[model samples]
Target: MDNYTPPFNQSLPQTAEGVPNKNSLSSYLPIRTKGNDFDFDAVIGLVLRGLLRKKVEGYSYEQFVADCQSAFEEKLGEEEFWQVLKEMYFENKDIFTVSPELLLFRAQKGEFAAGDSRVASMFTNLLQNMRVEEFEAKLNFVEREMLSTLREKMKPDSSLQASEKPYLPYLSKAFREDLKFLASRPKYLLSEIESFLSFYGFTYTVQLSLALVDWRSGQEPVAKPLYFIMDHERASNERTHIKNHGYKLFNESATRLFPMLTMLEILQPSSSEKGAIKVPLWEISKGIQESKLTHLKERLEKFARAFKSQRNLDTVLDESDAALDWLGNVMKLALAQFSIGERFNINKRYVLEVEKYLASHFIQNRGRSGRVLVLNQDYIILLTNLVVGEKDKLRFYELITAFEQRGIFVDKQTEQELIKFYERIGNVERMSDSGDAVYVRKTI
Candidate 1:
């Protein structure tokens, strides 16, 4: 035969002296060391123990299970450990009876069975042990629900019915109980009070009542026609010394107070009628005074050069047109103040400032297109540009003071009247000072 050589000649021999080489023997015999040294069954037992502890301590089932999984992964290699875990605690019933040591030994020996039914049975036992903890968590959830329901009951109703009685008695006992609870939590109770006051009807009533009280206490007896209109309804049975005065002064006071009342009405919804029936009179009077001042300032500017030219002797000069114009402007300004005060439900001071700032720009620019500036009741055609340059401040104040001082000759009494007006409504202090107050400057 032609020198026949075997194809297997290069292959390593199976063994030395008829036995395979060490590396070659591994392929056939498959030298199996411990597949995983960890005892998964024992780990399951440890997790069960932890679950029992957590359940006793009132932890939820879900929380207990999560903790168990976390502990196992932290202590063992995540991959090998969980796989073995699923086989033992989940996939085999033997895990429950077998000690962790025996389960681990069997697992290393590769002898555990796997199936969903076996896992299900194991989980059933695990959940049964966690029942107490689940009940505790459910109890906590129920407590939260009860507390929330109680809070809803304690909250005051802001809606006004035809009959103006207090609605607190209509609330359920549970609501009363909630109020008690809220009272114990002072912070939350205050929050509820704030929310109650925020309701339009409630705010209007409270503000009106407070304002009436303040106005009654603040002023002395006067004989103006305006005051009479304000006190006309109660002028007959004058128990208080102030009401003995003529109603005209009361009407003026009422006229002054009308702006505030109008503001309250405007700020509140039409449906709201919760508190007082009438607006206070002093607020209207204050509003009127402020408007007259602003008008006086404007009219004075026109007559400044004329009066200055006449050496302050322009009093006898006939300026019927200017006087009529000034009167009309004052009326318009008063209406504007009332409108803004009502719309924003703000103080007269704030309303006057906002109007002044707006009017300055409108007059300077000679009006803008499609840009209606409604200041309280006064309407102009220029939007207030908040952006101010360095020199803008001095210029604005100079104009306002000059306008005020100029009226000294043309209408000396009105000029004096305007000075008192500025003291009450204008923010002259903020104007003279250069600070962040500029951002909040209400008028020119």
Candidate 2:
């Protein structure tokens, strides 16, 4: 087991054969040190392109500079022109492009390229499921609230291009339905919708990537549950227990990622487990227990045969006790190859690095608890807007349930804090003292 070879299946999934298998461990997780610059605006750009079926037009940084020069060369001197250009375009905080250095309307080219297109493309492809006519109708509503005339002028021509490859995206039905419902709402701003898409885009990508970590031939597809402990950004000393419980639950969920991936990699390949991977999001909120591996006897026999064939082992261990010993050795081998430790850094790269990058927005760090799941104010507002789509307000209790459906959980203490926060911001209407009678409105 100590001298075991790494089991990396280089083959593409059967559903997507003959196409290039660009999916390595890094491609799946996408948490490289240099690739940590994930911009939400850029994510929106990619998703918009994907939804519109537009090609990556070669709009280079040089071309953009030249365009700026042509547009304002006569209006101002070289120094003044550059200063104005920087202030108007580059320094403008509202501009949403794949790279801030480049314009938003087109795909970037040359040395200043699109940052993290692979991950961005995941969102783009997910949005490709939408219809063109419906998207165009929604775009009309978004166009009504343009922040700048330059953003309007820089918009690409109506001509669009379609993707050559088919997309096979798998998301929980509840999330998928909610996303569509949010998109259909005409009151929401384009930036707000983009924020909603970007956050969920990253969340689903993380879950989907981890779920497919053990992908093999004839294996059942599953969505690994991502439990988020919705933290109250403002809480008093007495509410510390609420946060502690959240931290514990969050750690439990995050730490299980690698072990679950490893377990599926080893166990599922040897058996015929059929059914969609139904993740119990709310059920585990009470407390999570370690998953016990079952059907060891049958799995051990199959694993022994496969191991003997692959490693060419000649040992004849047919008895139950001897088989158990071999099974232990096999488990150790698989753990060494897949788990994050001195031996292998798979967990470090895929799990830890991802959480590190997502901090400040999707995650929160507190007193020795490390990275506990959280949604910052900006995200909370975006989510609230989406959850309250097409409606003036939603019942406070129903709103919490909606959050759960999207993989976010909040306890009673946190719930009270949330209502207070919302009330302070003028988004909640309290009909009675009870939390159930309260109604929350969309800030959009």
Candidate 3:
């Protein structure tokens, strides 16, 4: 595989060709774990650190305990300080220890869920210049300022520094725009703000996964622009037409891992193409799934030759009508290093796990289809707040358009449901009986 060169429209890693090149498929739609649940706070911490582009330093529990002791031991007795600390951090006070480091520090392991890396990478790439004021406002003064002081004081002493920082670029214009919209708002320290970020992260990740496409027809491969339809959580099963069609499309696209990788390989230019492409989100939706079957077949042949052994190469090259067979063949060849046997289900190995990854966050099983894309009330409210931004409110239709630009779609029935939901929550203002006159206000 290392020695093989791709055909004109196909690709492998373009390491020697240029800067800002994607090393693997993970660069485009990063899913590094086989199957693991996300830890939201850990993901937030990692993303915050990446956004700063600073040297990472750990703050030990021992140092944290000592700092607390020095600051509060005089004001409150030593025993009282320990009691307060235990009450604040742990539900079980019996686990408290005198040295204090063992409680939190001993359980430290640097492991994070697979999606966490993808989320953090995508976030940092999408948001390169986060406003300091907004960050501080969101986290509040104590979390921002005291953590800074404590980190500076307790930072590990090490001469070694990162040799080089990685160059991760934004892969989707839609995501970049939406993230910028969210960041532009005044950061509120409301309790619901944490839920907003958590759901936003999950929604964006699922949208990216569902909208991804690999275009192999042209001389160069291209990532087809992203868009997806979503059903309101309360949407009726019989009334939904566009939402059902959108779900069918989403289900088909969601399990495609190889095409995603192919798109990444194609998009990774020798030189950065950041300035080369800038199209309105509406213009991009027209180009989705434009790749020809013949082109995909040709790319598959090249992939089989590059990765398969002599015995398996002929087997993979055999003609097939099923897209699943083709994908399974490619997965088997590309992942041949893992020595996957012929009897094992390839879809379970490479495809189904992705669907499983999106389980409760972006997908639900309430509909007849078992798994369908859904936007619940909380996410809609958060999205509304961000889209409305500093404005008092936006025209209801315009707000819907903004949601579409961020790859979220709703049908007429769903839109009516959304308006009612907002109205019930007292965030919607109606000028008249028509949907066009309704305005959506920011919840924050």
Q: Candidate 1 residues 293-317, lDDT tens each?
A: 3333334324332322322222223
Off by over 4 Å in 2: 1-23, 26-28, 32-41, 59-106, 109-115, 125-128, 131-190, 193-198, 205-249, 255-336, 339-341, 344-346, 368-371
What is the C-alpha local distance difference test score of each model?
0.27, 0.47, 0.47
Q: How close is each model in CA RMSD to the real structure? A: 39.6, 10.5, 9.5
Task: Compare candidates 1 and 2 on lDDT and give the better one.
Answer: 2
Candidate 1: C-alpha RMSD after superposition: 39.6
lDDT, residue 329, candidate 1: 34
> Clashes per prediction?
43, 0, 1
Best by TM-score: 3
Off by over 4 Å in 1: 1-143, 146-238, 241-444
Kindly list the per-residue Cα lDDT of model 2 for residues 318-437, writing each as its tens digit. Answer: 555433344444444344444433423545554565566543366666554454556667777777876787789999999987775565666576677788889989999999999889
